[model samples]
Target chain A: MVMHYPNGQPYRTKQLSLKKSPYPTATLYGNRGMTLEEEINESNQYYLKQGIAVIHKKPIPIQIVNVDYPKRSAAVIKEAYFKQPSTTDYNGVYKGHYLDFEAKETKNLTAFPLANFHAHQIEHMKACQKQGGICFTILRFTSLKEVFLMPASLLFQYWDNQQANNGRKSIPYEIIKKQCAHITYQLQPKIPYLTYVDKLLEQIL
Target chain B: MVMHYPNGQPYRTKQLSLKKSPYPTATLYGNRGMTLEEEINESNQYYLKQGIAVIHKKPIPIQIVNVDYPKRSAAVIKEAYFKQPSTTDYNGVYKGHYLDFEAKETKNLTAFPLANFHAHQIEHMKACQKQGGICFTILRFTSLKEVFLMPASLLFQYWDNQQANNGRKSIPYEIIKKQCAHITYQLQPKIPYLTYVDKLLEQIL
Candidate 1:
């Protein structure tokens, strides 16, 4: 089903279909057609139930201007505007470590655009890192049908380079595949991203 | 303005008039009609702008079951339900300290109702305290026209008492005034609750 915004614009679901080949497909369930946000939200619920992590998507901040009060019981928001959020999408605690991250999907097969990220989000991640929290980004390459957990440190390098007039504003897909670890999905755990986190923790320790 | 929930119930706004008259009558304007939530939010923005702290109110969780897409840029949520939140309203950092709090207001002239809080919220606060974070509740008595920064440790005692069949489920206004520090508002820092935080930190240190 297609979703339209208030302005009647179609909302794009970042669901990529994997090519059926002799080799194992990198994308998980090409037919499910679930958006990245929905899948991640489900994964978070799974994580919460298993007593693993308690990450959650921050609600889209809206400036509520007017409301209609029909009765003493119910209040209906009559007018509101979406406000730009100053932080990343998800945050919570995992194994005594504060986890924060942003997930983005790109259709380009060769590179992932840096413009998908906001300056404030990058600054927030930097602050989180300074506070000894685990910060990262999940980048999904739709054309290649692959997803990788890229550390915020690596992301900052590209972000800083872009400010310094770097040749390209996107990180090449090859670099991500080689440097970052892949998160697999399981029945109970759903998003097995914590396994990669365990590895990152091991390296940090 | 009236805001209605999805269930067609009018959302109740906590009134903020005080009756005890501790300070001068002129100061009563500051105490009139401002919710504990609104005060704390303004305080947080003050803290953020000064680089003194970084705290934010978490978004209300909602479960969207269906959506209608009319265009590629917007997704109108057609069917959604509010989900129970598992954490406190506000959380972030202040001087390398993890700060967490829940803001509550009561209209009772004699006491602050314990029922204004939830079991899960108390549990979350306890958990954060166990992890060495500063957790507290900013309580406002609208009828009494007063606000108090009650620590989680003190709050837990009252919460525990309620479960033990204590007939009194509310904290007396006199007890709050004696035990917890009262917050005064400033021009820039509207809530000025962090002044109480400084005292708490001193005691902890």
Candidate 2:
């Protein structure tokens, strides 16, 4: 979902856009622009265009309360609210594999916070994984400009331990760097995440 | 994406609802109450609850133009427009099968019109099919209240032949009745189309 601005930057987090803000707050991804979602989406476009993969980011579900339909015109949504999605943000077929994952960006440098995810997303991913789908999470360290694709199973262990009252609220960045595969940012594809998926395929075969 | 109205009807195609219409015209599925999208969504819910399958309709993508943010409250979308979806609506893991399909309804008794589909959707199903995804289209005759799941390959043949002047613009009702497996609607699942998929899997094995 690339919303191109005059600045030539992809608008992924357009809600926080200063151009649309009458009540301005601190920015999220607007400072440098080109969010992880934007990059990954671009990469997905490249993957699809080249017949490499067919991944897509699931759109956020919304409840429409009011609509205005003009005669001989496209309908306009007047009132709506975002609803909590039951599944992860991204999913599609990748080389005969059903690939599913969620991408999250955290400003925290020390660790990736678990609070970024919802319980349903975890459950959905787990279900997909159980049914032979390849599941993972793309974690983007915005401040660090580092991205990693972490296995869903590892994230689940940390999530399950949360109920014990002794579990860490976040996974250490060091652990992520050690465990997950680093994706090299490419010029054309932007975020070359599928190379890591190729490695997963190798492991599976 | 169940948009439940007080009528106990699932709110599929609710965004295009014409209640606020200054110019009142004929309605789509909203008139009769539950849409084919609704029945399929209801069936999907049943499937998820029973651990039979984990299918979900993809959210309709929207481009938000203006939002109002009151202090200390969730933001409200004031203006937005629906974006044309790039792929099929429903997809998920079904008995380890990567299932992907689109659902449509036409009141025309004699035939199901080919104009109901778009070029991009055909390309998407083809790509998914090439990758061994179980691709199909759920066709519902609203007047008859009958449903059939037609394989993408069969649909593709009709779609490709449409370029030729001699090709038919719509598939005859009799052809669908003879070629596709009929879905017997039941109380629990409402639209139990997956039973036909089970038969397809048997053919595969």
Candidate 3:
């Protein structure tokens, strides 16, 4: 059995990032040993340092039950539990637009399972959309090594259909390929999704 | 021994929110026994529910060092520590603009101390401001029960002055009153800050 983080990254992958890469500057796909979250984090760092954007992954929510304070050391949390996030994983300002997104990679090559998303996340995105925020998903088909930036508006259609029991449990890859902007991974940014965000802004605004 | 959360919220004040108020709907100033965080959360809830804005307080960041997974039970975080946040407390979208802010309450009557802010938070806000996001601080004078929304641009002037070792360590109450927009406590939203955000939008844009 494989454990997974609340954000949907595999628990085993956490250690992979710690392992020093033989080729740290590898631009080749699948050679970097980087998870989607790590790649995005690197990209965010690049964007921030380059003065391109200011995006951040919201820290995982934890319910601290007990804490211990030593004589002179930093306080230690003795007991706590992960709390389900009420919103998406990532959000920040980008070129005057409110950018919000969740990144998920699926092993399934044919369809992206809707189980990766929670109802609250969809609802949160809808509320954000109503407020004119640029909401979307950074979805990756891991086996295929393909990624796409799917607009929240397009996501809502599938979500509503699923909720109404009017569609399949997963979105077919074909539809995703049609409706979403395919993002190619790059060395500098890892994932140049913001270029698509610029396209999204033009269409929506 | 006073305990403070990483966000600067008092530990004792945490229990105050759980107490059943005799006058739940009391509009009297400081009679509700609510902290500035609680009030801002209430206002964000109101805004989110009313489709007014999609603001939310980022959860306090924690670094999980160990976890215990018992049989058929939720994974318990056995070891963790509070991490200094890299960004402001509250951030989200309002009418297409990215809104970022930190909320701090001062007991001092004469001035709001600059010590409440972290350097990284100021740096983050400056970056957001560069992206054309509406960044500010929601300052509360707890003793006087006054709230003010000071724009980040104005804050930079004072922050830079202090950093240069050429100015006072605190912004005087009179200066805050003059430079910031005063916000009044209200029943529904608790803190009617967005009304001033609209005005801010007009001025900035």
The lDDT for every candidate, in the order shown, is 0.68, 0.77, 0.80
Candidate 2 backbone collisions, by pair: none
Residue B87's lDDT within candidate 3 is 90
Error of 3 at A172 (Å): 0.4
Q: lDDT rank, highest first? A: 3, 2, 1
The candidate that wins on lDDT is: 3
Model 1 C-alpha lDDT per residue in residues A1-205, reported as the tens digit of each score: 6554432323444442343334222122212223566667788878766666656677655444444433333334444433466788777666666677887887788888887788898988887677677789877776676778899988999998998876579888888888888776567555678788888888775
Stretches > 4 Å off in candidate 2: A1-34, B1-34
lDDT per residue for candidate 2 within B5-87, as digits (tens), equals: 64232354635553455432223422433468778899999998887888999987777766665665555777777667789
TM-score of chain B of 1: 0.82
- In TM-score terms, candidate 3 sits at 0.86
Q: Which candidate, 1 or 2, has the higher TM-score?
A: 2
Residue A25 lDDT in candidate 3? 22
- The per-prediction tally of clashing pairs is 29, 0, 0
lDDT of 3 by residue, B1-205 (tens): 4555543433645355345444322211222223787889889999999999999999877776676655556667777776777898899999889999988877789998887777898999999999989999898998898999998887888899999976888899999999899998889888989999998888999
Provide the clash count, candidate 3: 0
